[model samples]
Target: MLGALAQAVERLPPARRWLVGLSGGLDSVVLLHGLAQLGGRVGSPGLRAVHVHHGLHARADAWAQHCQVLCDALEVPLDVVRVDARPHRGQSPEAAARHARYQALADQMAPGDALLTAHHRRDQAETLLLQLLRGAGPAGLSAMPRWQPHGSGWHGRPLLDMDRPMLEAHARENGLVWVEDDSNGDLGLDRNLLRHEVMPRLRQRWPSLDTTLARAAGLQAEAQELLAERAREDLQTLRGEAAGTLSIPAIRALRRPRQRNALREWWREKGLPAPNQNRLEALLQQIRDVGPDSGLLVTWPGAEVRGYRDSLHAMAPLPLLDPASVWSWDGIRDLALPELGITLSAQEMLRLHGLEPALLEPPLTVRLRRGGETCRLRGQTRILKKLFQEAGIPPWERDRIPLIHAGDRLAVVWGLWCCDLPAGAGRR
Candidate 1:
C-alpha cells in the first residue's frame, strides 16, 4: 500500500506540502502510518494531518482528540477544523457532512499542498452504486477521482485501489487503534444500509465485486473525458462575442444529442449542475421560442441561463439590489457592497476612470442606479444608458453597478463611466 501511495504522489503535480485527512478510522490510521514511515526514510515534503470536526455526531469532539493523539505519537503536525454540517431542506445528512468536510479541508490547504484521503476500493464501489441509484450520468458514475484540483492545490485518494480488508489487516498488525463512529451502525443511513446489508449479500455471490465495480467506474471516467473533449470543440464553434455567451444559431446547427452534450459541457465549465433530461427538454423548447433582442431567463438551483439578442449566457443566478438603497461611506478604506458582491476602492481613481481623489470624503453616500441619471464622460452629458451602451456593457450588469457620490455631485461609477475631476481635486 505504501509503494502504491508513493507512486500516486509522484504522479501528481509538483507540491511542496501534503495534507492527510485523518478521520480517526481504521483506514485513515493505516494511511497516516504508512506515509509517516515513508517520510522518515525518503525525506518527504511537509506532511500534516487534518481532522474535520463535522459537529453532527455526539462523539465528534472525541474523534478529534483521538486523531490528535495519533498525530502526536507520529510527530506530525495536526489541524482540526470545526464546521456546521446541518442538512438543508430536502438534503441528506450524509451529503451535508461530506460537503462541509470538503469545504473545510479546502480552506485549510495552502498554495502547493495536496489533500490525501483514505477512500479505498470498497468505498469507490459503494459510491458507484449510490450514484447509479440516483440516475447520474457518466460524470457522476466516474466515482472518486484519483487526483484533481482542490482549492489552490490538489486532492487525491491514494488508497483507491486497495481493498478494505488489506487496510484493516495493516492496522491490526501495527497495533494501531482507531475510533469508530457509532452512526455507522445505524442502518437508517443510506450508505450504512448498503454497506451492512446490500454489499455483503452481493459479496456472497461475486467475490471480486469491489475490484470489478471500481474498474467499471474507470471505464466510465474514460468515456466522460472523450465526451468533454468533443464538447470543447463544439464550444469553440458556438462561442459568441462574450466570454460565457454562446451563439444561438451555432448551437441550433447541431443535432439534439450534440446540443445536449455541448450544453452539459458548458455547465461543467461554469461549475454549475447539468440539467437532467426533463429540464433539457424544457430548455430546448425555450431556446426555440426565443426571439431576437428578447430577454429570457431559465433557472435551476445554482445556475441561470439567460438569453439576450442572439447569445445565450449561463452563470450563477443574478442578484437583485435596490437602486434606491444608499449607504454612507468613509474615504479611509475600501467600501464593500455585500448585495452586489463587489468592493469600491480609492486606488482606481486613475486606473478605472477619470475621477478626483479628493471627492471620496467621509459621509459621502454610496448609491445604486435609479435610471434617468446622466454622467459627463469626455465633456458630454450622456445618459447612463447611452454610456453603458457605448462601452458595450451587457444589459444585465447595468443594475449591479454602484454609484459613488460626494454630496450632490456624482464622482465615480463602479466598472463603468466616471465623472470629470471635482472642483478642488487635480486631474490625472
Candidate 2:
C-alpha cells in the first residue's frame, strides 16, 4: 500500500500543497501514515491533515482529538473544522453532513492545494452499485473518480486502486489505532446496509465481486470521457454569441440523444447540476413547442434552462425579481440591486459598454420599467414594451433591467438601450 501510494503521489505535479481529510477512520488513518512515511518526498506537497467535525455523533470531539494526536505524532499541522450538519427539509441527515463536510474542507483549501481522501476499490464498487440501483447514466455510474476539481483546488483519491484489505493490513502492521464510527452497522443508511449485509452475501457467491464492479466502473468512466469529448465537439459546432449558452437551432438539429448529452455538458460547464429526466423532458418540450415570438424557461432544483430567440441559456437558478421594487440612484455612484441580482455600477458599464464619465449625471433615479413607459429613440417616441419586443429582448429580462431617469426624463436602459443624454453620454 505504501509503495503504491508513493508512486501515485509522485506521479502528481510536484511543488504543490496537499491536505488529507483525516476522519480518524481506518482508511484515512492508513492514508495519513503512508504519506508520513514518504516524508519530504519530491511530490509530497507540504503535507497537512484536516479533520471536519460534523457535530453529528456524540463522539465527534473524541474523533477530532484523536486526529490531532495522530497529526502531532506525525509532526504535521492539523486543522479542525467545525460545521453544523442539520438536515434541511426532506433531506437525509447523512447527505446534509456530507454537504457540510465538503464545504468546510473546500473552505480550508487554497487555490493549488489538493484535498486527498481514502476512498478505495470497495468504496468505488459500492458507489457504482448505488448509482446503478438509482438507474443512473454513464456519468453517475463512473463513480468516485481518481481526481476531480474540488472547490478552489483539486481532490485526489490516491488509494482508489488499492483494496480495503490492503489498507487494513498496512494499519495493523504499523500498529495504528482508529476510531470506529458506531453508526457503521446502522441499516437505516442505504450504504451501510449494502456494506454490512448485501456485499458479504454477494462476495460469498462471487469472491471477486468488488474487483469486477470496480473494473466495470473504470469502463464506464472511459465511456463517459468519450461522451464528454463528443459533447465538446458538438458544443463547438453549436456555440452561441454568449458564454455557456447554446444556439437553439443547432441543438434542435441534433438527434435527441445528442441534444440531451450536449445540454448536460453545457449545464455542467456552467457549474449547475444536470437536469433530471422530468426537467429534461420539460426543457425539450419547451424548445420543440416554442413559437417564433415566445420565450420559455424550464427549471429544476439548483438549475434552469431558458430559450429566447436564437439561444438556449443554462445557469444557476435566477433570483426572483419583483418588478414592483424600485430604487433611486445617482448615475455617478454604483447601484447594487440585491433583489434583482445585479450591480449597476460605473465601472461595469464602462468596462462592458464604454459608459463615459461625462454621462455621470447626478440624482439619476433607477427603477424597474412599469407598463406605459416611453422613450424617443432616433426620432419618434416608442413604447418601452414595443421597443423591447422589436429588439427581441426576452420578456423575463425586461422588468428586471434597471431604467435610469435623468431628473424625470427617461435617459438610459441600464443594459438594453441608452437614450441620448443632455451630456451626449448615452450616444454610444
Clash totals, every prediction:
0, 0
Cα lDDT of model 2 by residue, 174-272, tens digit = 999999999998999899989999999999999999889989999999999999999989999888776656888887899999999988888888888
lDDT of 1 by residue, 320-351 (tens): 77678997776547778889888776666556
* Candidate 1 segments exceeding 4 Å error: 1-14, 40-43, 330-333, 357-363, 376-381, 389-391, 406-411, 419-428
Count of clashing pairs, candidate 2:
0
Task: List residue ranges in candidate 2 displaced over 4 A.
Answer: 13-15, 41-43, 330-333, 346-363, 420-428
Question: Which residue pairs of candidate 1 clash?
Answer: none
lDDT of each: 0.84, 0.84
